[model samples]
Every structure is written in structure tokens, then in C-alpha cells.
Target: MRRSTRLSLALVLTAAAALAFGCGQQGRLTSPNDHASALSARPAFDPSSVRVVAAMASQDRATPALLALSGVVGTGTSIDAAGDPVIVVYTERARVANLPEAIDGVPTTVVVSGTVVPYARPGGGPLQMGTSTGNDLECAAGTLGCVVVKGGVDYFLSNNHVFARENAASLGERIDAPGRYDAHPICNQTPQCANLSQFQAVSFSSNNTVDCAIARPISGLNYSAAEAGGYTPASTTVAAAVGLAVKKTGRTSGLTHGTIEAINVTIRVQYTDGIATFVNQIQTPGNFIRSGDSGSLMVTETGNNPVGLCFAGGSGASFANPIGPVLQALGVAIK
Candidate 1:
């Protein structure tokens, strides 16, 4: 509905569930047992041998940060060691105030809403999916997704657009971080359409002007396996060397490859269907993003080190906000 940053909003969370969808941040809920149960219902993928990728919230778990946010948001090796998601919770949460006791899943988040603290990237870093189901939600309330681990509780993550109309994410909203839209017959806008579809809103994510939101999946849903898909992880090395080959994967365009046209260059972007535009903002070209490619992870070809994440693209070109901003905004690490 509106625009916001995923990480920045997550920084001020707890009670966002009711405020979600501009209906007063009433979040969703599920049981740990339900997560396990979902696994049986979850689609399968090749965890041992697979290419990795990343996204705000999807069913595919072949790449790192599988439907989950990084503890320290940055380029990390996509691996298949965990499932479920990383949750961000405030100690003073209102409804799910005592959320922990009521929740299951591991690699949890318990930072305060207004507290500005330096967070340490957990040992698990960003996750790579072992299983997948590539589902997503548009922008709604009460919907969420979760990231499941091998033996841990799942966390939540969502789009900033979902909570764009709210002051901040509320506490105690039962949601599936990185959710898939599930068609509901009762509330079916379309007989075959899902209420929220496969996408879930577990955490606070963004499409912010300065920052993109990304958070841990906190409840319900299962995020078993890590990220996996048809894309390759961009291996990279330090020093943004020129002529480096890179690639990207997005919801619209599958996988596209390009070179580091230039780093630290200015670019322009479109926020809405309006005729206005944002000009010459800092940008990177390693991964040129087209429409619907915002938040696409851009990596270097050398060692797969993350170089940038897609922000915008135009005039036969693309732009990104560098992985550094994602890390700074999320208070996490790269690995």
C-alpha cells in the first residue's frame, strides 16, 4: 500500500501485528507443532546440491537467508543447515509480550522497539534453503511467514509495504514470515485466489527510500531447509574491481547476468505509477534490476561476496543500494 524500509521498521517493532494492513496491527499466530506439521505439507528440494538465492519472502529455500533475514544482514554463504526463520521481538510486546514462551523455532530476535543497540550477527548467519515452495504475499495485514531451522524455532519477515500505513509493527500478531499466499474459500476474492496467497508477513521489511526492511520470522509457519533455486550465488572479493561479471534473480525476470558497469554511480528510480521520479541517487550496476527487482541480491563473480542489492532500474539500466546499507539497517553481519 505504501513504502518503507524492512530493517529500519524492524528496529522499531513489537505490536505491529495489529497495526498491519492499516487495520491496527493485529498480527497472526500459529503453533510450533503447526510448523512441524507444515513440513509434511511443504514442498521438497535438493538441499545437498543446489544453487542459492535470496528474496524478501518466498517459497524457494535454496539460497542463504531462506525466507529469512540475516542476523547481520549482508552477503553470507548460502548453506543448508537450518530452517524456520529468525524472529525479532521486543521485551515489552503488548499481546505477544510473553511471546517467547508461547512460540517455538530458534535463532530468535528479542531486541527492544526503540532501543538502538549494536547487534551481533548470530553464528548461523544468513540461511540457505534445503526445501522450497516459492510463494509470496502482496501487501496485507495479519499475514506473515516463518524461517525454520533443523532444530530451532522459526522467525518472521515481511514487506515494509505491508506495514507502510502503520506507525510501527505491533506485538502479538500471528504471522508467517516469508509466507506463501494460501487461497481461502471463505474470503476468496477469486474462487481460486488465496487470501494472502503463499507469501507470509513474519517480520518488518521495506521498500524504503533510504533503507529496505528485513526481519526475522517470529512465529507459526515452518521455514525448514534453506534457500535454493535456479540462480547462482555471486562469489566475490573485496575491492570493487571493474570488469567483474555478476548476475541477479528476481520475481519478474528469472536470472540475468551483467558486469560491474560502475560502482558509486548515481541512478534514478520510480516509486509509484506517477510521472515523478527520484534522480541520481548512489547506485551500483553489477546486478541491474528491472521492475519488481527491488531487494534483489547482487553479488560479485570472483568469490561471491555481496556487492549490492537491487533498488531500482531504468533506461535500460539498474541500480542498487549496496549490501552495506542492508547490514547497517539490519544491524547484522556479512560472512
Candidate 2:
């Protein structure tokens, strides 16, 4: 007989954490026969150009001072309407007085984004990507970004907070599909839920570039790379560039589209355990993600090539780790 356990409301309430923060079945993974391929053309803006690199350097140098300013939250590189590289400063309020118009000869702009927080509001099949998932020990939930292959083994991809409990989970910990919050009373006790085991997760105790983790599937259960809404991400990864159109499918926000607002970003994100700083990240404006949407993969809208791994967000902005760094950090390739 299957054991059933009812979760208490307090456990659910305690699960609230930053968005930057998921399991299934003995079923073979299935994907569409025709998966999306990378776009044949390159973006107009060359992020590797000298001008863009100089602007990125300027942003990096000024980040310390800018983050110290009142209302300032983060800083990054962006492209202005004139198609020139510029420095972007993010603030909690509408404006921060006395911010410079330019940094090291590069132009500057300000964006009113509230305090950035991890989106961990915290999902089935051979469980699909971009669905609800979470640690079985807690009531919180978050999105399972996608699948990656390492050493010929398949693993589920998502933020550390979602699978590792912000570095609190041990290796081989159980992860539940639909997360505890989404599962509610039944939680991880249902046959429909797929259970996964923790594999690799970056520790939050040190400075990290990506808030990412990978979980191995229990025997018999499998996962598919196909995201919700039928979007298929390419196996290759691309660097983020300002003005690049992108889209993501997540647990909270389904499939939402937005343009790359900034890149080479340096920002501090509030997690359940503490504040952590991430450098060289990707930023998007408006409602790209909401609570429980962290871990959604940000891919190029045109060809669905992977670009960034969604993690944190603030009032007018959402943030992600560049896919290259995320993959390198976890030593995995997109499946």
C-alpha cells in the first residue's frame, strides 16, 4: 500500500525563498522528431567587439561604487537606442540622484528595478522541462529548467536553491516533481510524481557565477528536453547580447517572451540562506518570469538556441546566468 502524508500550512509558509531556486518515471524520454536548430545568421551587435568589451570593462570597474550608492541595486552593459554600447545601472527606486551620464567615456543609463530576489515560488511524463519541481524535504517549488548530459548520463537542470535547498541538500537527496507546493497535501507520495536524486550543485558558501544544480533520475524514470508549450531548445549555447529577442517557459509564467535588456551584468541576489553576488549574467526587462519561474532556460526566440539560465528577478527585470558559464560550471552539455 502507498503511504499518504498531509503537509501542514506552516511547512508551506516557511518555504518562501528567492526565485533562484525539481523528478519522474521508468519511462523512456521522448522528444519531437524535428527539434529546433540554431539560427543560421548572427545578431547585428557584436558582443566581442572592442567597443562592447570596453563598455563591459567600464561597467565592471564602476559596479562596486554604483552598488554602494543609495537605491542602486546592480549594474551591467547595455546598448542604447543609437545602437552603441552603454553602461546600465539598476536601482530600487525610480531614480538615483547624481548618477554619472557616462563611465570611462561609455554612455550610461538607469533602470528602476526593485530589490532583486530569487524567484523560487516555489512539476511530469518522463517529466518535461520547464515544469514545477522541488526538494521533498520542503514545501517550496521551482521550475526544472531542462536536461543536460554528463558522462553519458542524463540529469535534470535547475537552480541550486530548487534542488539543493540553497546548498543545504546532500548528495542523492530526493527531489519531487510538481514540487511540494504544487503537490500540496499529497506532496511527493503520488505515483504520478517522479522522484530524482541530487547529483551536482554549486555551493553558496563561496563566490559563484551560476546558481545551478543537476539531479540524476531514479531508475525507471526518465526526462525529456522538450519544454512546456512545445518549445524545443537547441543543443548548442550562445552568448547573450543586448536587444537579442528571447523566450522561456517556466512553472509560474508558462511561455513568455522578452528582449535581452543587458548583459555582462554584476548583481546581488537575495536567497533564502543569504545574499550572493553573481557576475557576468544576463538581464531581461519586464515580465519574463514570476515566482516559481526560476531555472527556466532562456533561449533565442528565433531558433531556440540556449542563451541563459533564468535565476533571479526584481520588479521590472529578470536575471539569468549565461548558458556557457552555467554549462561549464556544472560540466554538462545541453541534451
Candidate 3:
């Protein structure tokens, strides 16, 4: 079969499998009855717990002090030695102003840190597992991973670097399937490349919470919870925990599985342009992810409940922004 034909068949088979397993019938991951349940299942470190303070800090009122005092990163919840909920406050310096007795009544701790940057580039791999980005840049294509709905519109999810070009792209940019690099030579020249338009982005300067963005596909385009290599995600999200068994489908590695190594991580990531710091993130062991897989979503094996949004990694370790804050910011729900 032709590459295009094979890809189409793959999407159809995926949708069929999703229907068969009730993982995402009709390409929808959450139903009205289950949306709340899925959101609630995303673990104890809830984003709602830190929303107010996060908003305040975003406005730049004592930014460092507020962020540290609130113990609010992307989402507020951290972990303790007993693996219980704690508040993690990150600062460039040891002392911050008005360090709180606790955040939302959770015990608070402070850590010195630097900027968290986005991971943009990675090496090559064969096509399999899940969807990929357009042919624009070799390192640009990541995984489409899953579907989401916002304002009653369907959107495909991936990393900002994958879709938005790491804060350098404009709204309504074009994204192609198999990415430009992974697509055929004639894919872009002819209209053979199945493409989507960049619809929305949570820009780095805007939220800096999750390295996330969404695209609007053409009306007849196909979506599925069935990833490449016949993997299906649960129709919900599981709260992330240390040692949780997790999996992801991406462009480079296909379907790779690993365990959650740590939670509530604060670290600096190096992007091409400069440095960006991320706080309250999740970490996975091994080089579970490579270049071209930056946008893959991390989910628990049980019911495939989403846990994190994979973005940057190095030294046999990868990081993801918790999913709760990501979806909340985008006004979208997993499909």
C-alpha cells in the first residue's frame, strides 16, 4: 500500500479499535457523565488548588515571592518523603518574601532553582506508534497523541514546540501529518499531505505552565484514542504518582512505556533561543523520550488516564507538565 493509504488505514483501524474497547467511541475520550470523573482522577496535586494564587503571580505582583510563597508552579501539589501531598516553592535564592506557613494548608518547602526551558530538537526514527507534526522543520514534528474538545470544537493536542514552533510561530500556522521530514518528497508540493491549522496556543510568555498547543483539523479528518502500534488509552486520566506505570505514543519511539520517577520537580531547560524554568513537573527514568517526541502525552496504563505533557528531557530523564493545568488553561477536555 502507498504510505498515504497505509496511514489512512491506520487511522480507521484505530477508530474501530477505540469503538470496540469503549476507550473512545466516536473519537471522544470523555462523555458528559465521565468528564468530571476523568478530571478528578488526575491525582492529588490538583491545579484548582492553586488557580487563584497562580493568576495573581502571573500578573507580576512580587512574582518571585508570590510564586515561592504560594508554592505554586504549573499546579500546586508536590510530594513528601511519605509520598503524601506537599507544597514546593522554587526560587533563585534561598529566602523569598512572605514565605507562607503553608499553601492551601499543605506543608511548604523551598528549593533554589533556575529557568525551565523547552526541548525542541531530537534525532530520527522510523514512523510508527502515533501521529506526527508537519514537514516544516526536521525537529518540529512530535506526536499528535490525542484529541480534545473546546467550545464544542475538536482540537488535536501536542507540545508548543511541535505546533507553535517554540513560541516563534503565528496563529493559524499549517501543520502536516507525518511532519515535513517524515512525509514524502511530493507530500507538500502536491496537496497529498493531510494538514491542520494551528488554532490555539498557550504561549510561553502567556502561561508558561504547560508547553502545550492545539490545532484544528479539516472537517473530514480522522482521530482516535488508538495510538500507533494498536495502543488504546483509557477514556480518563489518573493522578500521577511516583512509580506509576506510564506509556506514550510518539513519532520517533512509537509506543514506549516507562515509570514515573519523581513528581513536583523544579528545573531549568535549555531551548534554542534561551532558558526557561519549569516548576512542579513530573520526571521519568531513562531516555524514554527522544527528539521529535516532545509533545507526547504521558498516561497511566490503567484506563490511560492522562498524567503529564512531555516536553523536555536529558540524562536519561524526561519531564512533563501535569495534565490538569494544561487542559484547564486550554479550555479543552480529552477525547
Candidate 4:
């Protein structure tokens, strides 16, 4: 079943001015040649090479202004056909004009990305990763990204908006599986939705870097780390980089695969409370996720190593928080 909490694309762009997480405040971009000059010779086009890093820096520097543009929504670093690094700009409509061909010697590419918003409302059955879950106070739901271990206790992982009500939920608030939206007519009646979880922690501060939260399962709740589709993610995590092949199993979209289109992304996401700017994020082309897919865990296609936590999306792209920082911020490790 679908929920009607989807945020409009126009609302997301309008809220961009209220930057959260220090978006667009990083230092200015430097010349590409200067950045390359500092690194020792390496194979040309190495994704981690100096040129790519320089382009990322340039992207960070240019994000603020680009986001301010009429149709622009976000920006990130990418590689061009020649293997040279370029800055990628995400927009809400067709290509935005007047965007400079290059920024600080780094080329730029504009991609149409509609309006990106948090995926909420949309899961059932056993308490499992990638299934539907959410706080009991709302009629909505979102994907349970994965399982995690914190302080030796196992917990359910997902976006803050899913488990903590975007920082409005009190500690110990009840969380339900199949979410109220999925539970439908029975959710508010007898044999009400199962209360298998409780809010443990959520980080949604002004300087936050992740849109994540963890919940402790009530005693005796049956749960598993395996996602919907029997895809078990590795306990180990990997850093996100451009071109990495990744996959995720979510509530709305069962299982989907896509390439990491960009890295070190800075984008604005529209939430129930307001807009939030996320930096150092990972990006992938659209179709990887959809409404109700928030909280899906993005992992390497081959190794199943966790790389990012799916959160927001737009017309042509989706965004995630790098798993490294997410785990660190929550003081947890993949289970």
C-alpha cells in the first residue's frame, strides 16, 4: 500500500536556502593542475587520483552557488569520457543554462534530477532488514535498512525520520513492523500492528552528517540481517566512490542495481520538519530507489559489503550517506 506523505519537488528546492549540515561552507575549489601537481604520477583516470579529488573539492566549493540557482538541486564530482574529473550539477528540470562550462578549471555537467525527497511510507511479516518499519505515532513507514550492533546489543537500522520521527520522537517510543501504512485497516484496530521495536538513538542536529537512527527490538522479536530477497549484506563496510556497482532491496522497489554516479555530494533534502543539506554523500542514477525505499542499505554488488544508507532521491538520481560515517556517528557496527 502507498502512503501520501511524499514531499513535492518544488518544496525541496524552496527549502534549499535553509542550509543544514554546513552545506556549501567548505573552502573554495582550487585549480585542477595545482591539485594534480601535488600528487606523484599515477595511472591516468584512476578514480582516486589527485585530479578526481581536486574535482570533488571544486564540486564542494561550487555547490552553494549552484544550489542557489533556479533549477539546481545539488552537485557532486564525476569522471568525464576522457577520464578527467568533472563537476556534476543536479537540477529539477531540463538543463539549467548559464552554468559555467568549468569551475576553477574543472568541467561541469548538468543532469536533470527532478525533486529529491525522503522515501517514507511503504512494508510486512517477520521483522527483517529491507522490510517496512516505522514509529507508531505516524501512519507512514519506511524500509528497515539493516541490522547493527551497538554496545553489544542488536538494533534495527533506518533513517531518523523513520524511527525517530525526524528527531521529534521521544526515546523509547514504540516502532512497528509492516508500518501503519502497510498495516492498513488493521493498524488502528484489534491485533494492532506488532510493536517489535523502540527508538534507541537518532541524530538530526544542525551539523549532523547522517539521516540515520537505530531501534532496539523488544524481547523475543524474530529478526534477521538478511534483506528481503534473501540478500545478506556483509558485516564489513566499504567507502563509496564513483563508478562502484551497488544494489539495495527496499519496500517500494524490491531489489535494484545501479552504479555510483558521483561521490562527495552535497544535496538538500525536504523533510516533514524542514529542509536538510547533506554533504559528502553518495549518488546513483534513478530507479535504484523510490518512495518507501528510504533506509535501504546500499552494498557492493559483488561483495555485498555495505557502502551507503539510502535516504533521498530525485527525478534522475538517488542519494545516500556513506556507511563509514553513519556507523561511526551511531557508534555501531554492521551485524
Candidate 5:
């Protein structure tokens, strides 16, 4: 699906911090342990923060400081005594330069670690999180990626746009691994490709915020929770947060890592036929993600912790639906 222009509003707040991990008066949440507590506190930022961030990105302005920060992936509410949204900057360097106290009304928060590079998976060698995946037909390939459990079965996790044609696909459709695009290159000679049938469609839902679908796997095909490039699955899910380090393996982008740019973002996406508006979505920088990267499972780069389901991206930005809603809608769990 082609992405439409993102719609968002700017929201400014106060407070700031920069470091590997620590705490301060301005508000600093550097540990996963603090997520639950911070969430409970409800970071204080206007809902329009998404728009604010988008506008800043387009105008090349740095009012929130996040825009000016090169390594900063995005901004989100921070855990201050009073929960308020802080501009979060993500970087791979140990030491950052020219740290600011605050931008506009929002403060700055910095996270150090992880290079963001996007690549594609085009050939067939092994079945891993970065392997190609797609319909049995001519649709573009994506990542077959991720392992989830539903009804005691090992179902492959991916985006509905990938497996279900974005709500247009039917249940029980044939699913291919190494996707049709990769499985067969002589597509022009014939309408079909050498698709390796690996899984059968189970269910999909675009009803909620997620664009996810699952399929029951068949025997004889190799599969694993491990992602490409040696990142093993943590077999758990993590909440999306600013400054959180995350990774994903996709048909186009093998194993790439980046940080959460924005959460609870509402945006519009263009499918082949029409448009769909997604709300409460997770947005990230356009680092390694690209076409054929959709349906890749977004996970923590360090522990392989599941975070979100990547679906749409364009214009230096990518978006994913929260994993919680995707699992809830499908009644599944990370395997």
C-alpha cells in the first residue's frame, strides 16, 4: 500500500535529559523496569504531539529539539513527577554533543546505542525472521517473520497487508515463504512464480489499530523464532516507548535496528485500492525500513522482545500497530 501524507499536530511541553541511562528532575526513563510505572503515570503530552513531530520533520525546524538532534528517532512523553511528553533523542554514540534543556515546550531525552540500517531479504537460504513472505500469487513480497501462538498452533505472524491483502484477502489463502517475489524471478515468463507454499491463512483483522494476520504453518518447512543475523527471540513483548532500542527482520530489510520515534500516532495509509486511517500507531524513523519490509515484527534489538507489527512507511517515517492490540485482536501470543 502507498502511504498518504501524514496528518498530525504539534504539541510542546517542558523538561529534558541525555545519557546512556540515569534519572533527573527534568524526567528520565532509561530502564525497561520503569515502563510500567511510567505508563501508569500517563506521560503528560498533548495528543497532538504526533502532528507536532510531523510538522517539525517537514519544515526542517527544531522547536522540540528532537528535530535538530541527528540521532534522535522521535519524541514521546517522559516519566516526570508529573507525566508529560518529552522529546526523546536516540543515538548510537556513547557521548552526545550540544545537549539542550528543552525545545519549544517539550524537554529533551536522549538514549544512546544501536545503528539504524535497513536492508532487504531477496534470496532463499533459510527460514528466519528476515525471510521473504507473500501471497501465493503476484503481490509484492514481505517478511514471513515472527512466531506467535494461537489455539495451540504455531502460526506465522505478519501484516494483514502482507498476508491478507489489507482486509481484502480471504481466510485460508495460500501463503508462501521467501515470498513470490524472491521465490520466482522469472515472473514475466508466466503470471505465477515458484512460490514455496509454507503456511495456510488463519485469520486477519484491520478492525483495530494493527494491520496483522497469522497463518498456520505446514510441516517440512524450516522455521524458528530466531531472526536473521543471529538475533534470537526473547519470546516476550515490550511496550512501545521513546528511547527504546528496537530491531526487525523483513523481506527487504534483513536485520535492522532503530528507536521508537512516536507512540499513539494517528495517520493515513494508501492501499492499492483505497485509503485507511490508522490511530494509536507507533512511528519510527525511516532508517532500514522500505518496501517489502512490511509485516516484519518490530522487537527489542537487545533481547528480541516483540514490540510492534510494522506495516506502512514513507517519507522518512514508518509506522507499526502496537503488538498488544494485534495479539488481542487475534487472541495470540509470542511463541
Candidate 6:
């Protein structure tokens, strides 16, 4: 069924501490095991004190802080918690109805776009854009080369189609983000041992009903990319409109833009496998996204709040699943 109908919608930390115990217990003066308890009681920062990096975007609206690197940053909220990295739209921007508020008092500046991998499987693998088998796939076609999200457990969010041609259930292997400018590949080839350095999905799902997937990374592994001078997901509701200009960050296109032509247009997309498809969508008449641009974040001009996830676009049209529904499905808040 080829139709042009429309409607629209749509971690962790680990540290190693060296403990020094005096060789002679009688000679050493030490407190009891209460040290662990005290550490828990006295965290370095209050719940709200976790510092977040806020960057300024140029009139072009692209924030230097986020755009400095080739990655994703859509208008998102940190609804999960201030302490855990930031939370963003499941497939939408800054704010969704009833989602939590922005991290209390963080300063925000104008952003042309925020990079994102906006869609994920129900389990949490990212909806990425890449060939099932082909090129090195180093540079992406959009503003955001990649993105990070949280599912509260070992799972991280992503799109399953990134691994097309290969059987999803069969290709149970997970992918680690290829490091910048060549440090080392996250996952080694079949022969080598598992590298503890990068992210990986335990499994994936892209059946006829859903287009997303979840990959469980090492426990206590944070998908948050802010530490690398990039932006992560956060929730903040922003108003959207038809004809309102917007921008996006994705894996393929670093930073691009267009206007909202329509909203609430229902449509269908055949997942790469061709056996499964997704129905019901929010459509945009912009070419901000393309094939390799699968999991991009679509955002408003000023506040950088993401309005939708960039799926497929052609004929001067784009499609997205409202962030609101995505979160509800995931049962987590973005703000």
C-alpha cells in the first residue's frame, strides 16, 4: 500500500576507589564500616545541584556547545532524574503533556537543534541509520551523528532497522558507538574477547507492530553522552505549529531545517525488513530527514524543544511519532 496520507505525532556511573588499610590494625585508627553509609548520606551535590552544560546557539540557532561535535540533541527533558543523565522525548521534543519539568534552574540558550536518536525498540536499542552491510559508515547524513538515551535499567533505546538485511532476531549482537576520530571500535570482531569499553544491545525487536528496539548495555553503564561535550535527551514541552520553522540533529545530517507543513497526519512506514510496519504518524512537509537520517530529533527554532522524531521523508514530506505516545508506551517520563 503506497499512500501519501498524513497525521502526526510523536544510566549510570562507575568509579573505582582504592582503600588503604593499615597493615597493623592496632596501630591504625579507623572508623567503622559506616564509611559507606556516610557516603550515601552526603552526596556531593544535592538532587538539583548536578551541574549541566548549557551552550549558546548562534542566530543560525545552532548551539555551539551541542553542534561542536557531530551528534544528536533534540529538545528533550530530563524527567528521569537530575542525578541520572538527562531524559528526552521518546520520539518528540522538549515537553509532553504531564511530563516532568526541566531540571529546576539550569540556564538554557537558543539552540538551532539538539542531536538525537529519537526512536527505540520497546526493549531500548536505538533507531539508527546505517547500512546492514556496506561502508565503514563513519559520517552520518544529518547534523547528529549519534545520540544517547536512558531506559532506567541496563537497556538503551535505538531503532532496529539500523541493522537491516540481517535477521534482527538472528543478529542479536549489540553495537557500541564507534569512537570519534578513531580511538578504538566499541565491539571487536567475532574472534576477539568482548571489550568493556562501549555500548551494546543484548537483543533487538522490529516486528510488524513496532519499529524500535532496546539493547541492554553493561550494567551501570550510562548512555549519557554529555561527558564527551555533547548533548543528551531532556524533556521540556514547547508549543508547535504549522509553518513554524524548525531544525533537527541526526546521524546522517549534522544540522538541517524546514517548516512544519502539517500535524496529525496518520501514515504507515514499512520497517526496513518489509515484513513489519508502523501505522499512525505526525507528518511534516520538510526534507530535514532521509534514509540514513532514521533516528533524528526534530525541534522548534528557539527553545530547541524537539517536536518529533525524523523517520523517513520524500515528496517534500516527513513523518514522526509524537514524543508523548512514545514515553507512555515506554512507561517513563522525559522531563
- Stretches of model 4 off by over 4 angstroms after superposition: 1-126, 186-207
Q: Best-fitting candidate, measured by TM-score?
A: 2
For candidate 2, write residues 220-305 as lDDT tens digits: 87557899757888998879999999999999888999999998888888876678888898999858988888888999998999
- Put down candidate 3 lDDT per residue, 19-44, tens digits, no spaces: 21221111222222222232233343
Q: What overall lDDT goes with each candidate model?
A: 0.32, 0.70, 0.57, 0.70, 0.61, 0.35
Root mean square deviation (Cα) for candidate 3: 24.4
Across 257-314, the per-residue lDDT of candidate 5 in tens digits comes to: 8989899897877776566778888988986578888888888878778888888898
Report per-prediction Cα RMSD to one decimal: 18.9, 23.4, 24.4, 21.0, 19.6, 21.7
Ranking by TM-score: 2, 4, 5, 3, 6, 1
Residue 89 local lDDT, model 6: 17
Runs in model 2 lying further than 4 Å from the true structure: 1-125, 186-206
Candidate 6 local lDDT, 61-169, one digit each (tens): 3322232433323222221222332322121233323332332333222222222211221123332322111111221112122233455443333343432112324
What's the TM-score of every candidate structure?
0.40, 0.61, 0.56, 0.60, 0.57, 0.42
Model 1, poorest ten-residue lDDT window?
Answer: 185-194
Worst 10 residues of 2 by lDDT: 15-24
Better of 4 and 6 by lDDT: 4
Over 4 Å off, model 3:
1-129, 135-139, 185-207
Positional deviation of residue 270's Cα in model 4 after best superposition, in angstroms = 1.2
Give each model's clash number. Answer: 119, 21, 24, 3, 19, 74
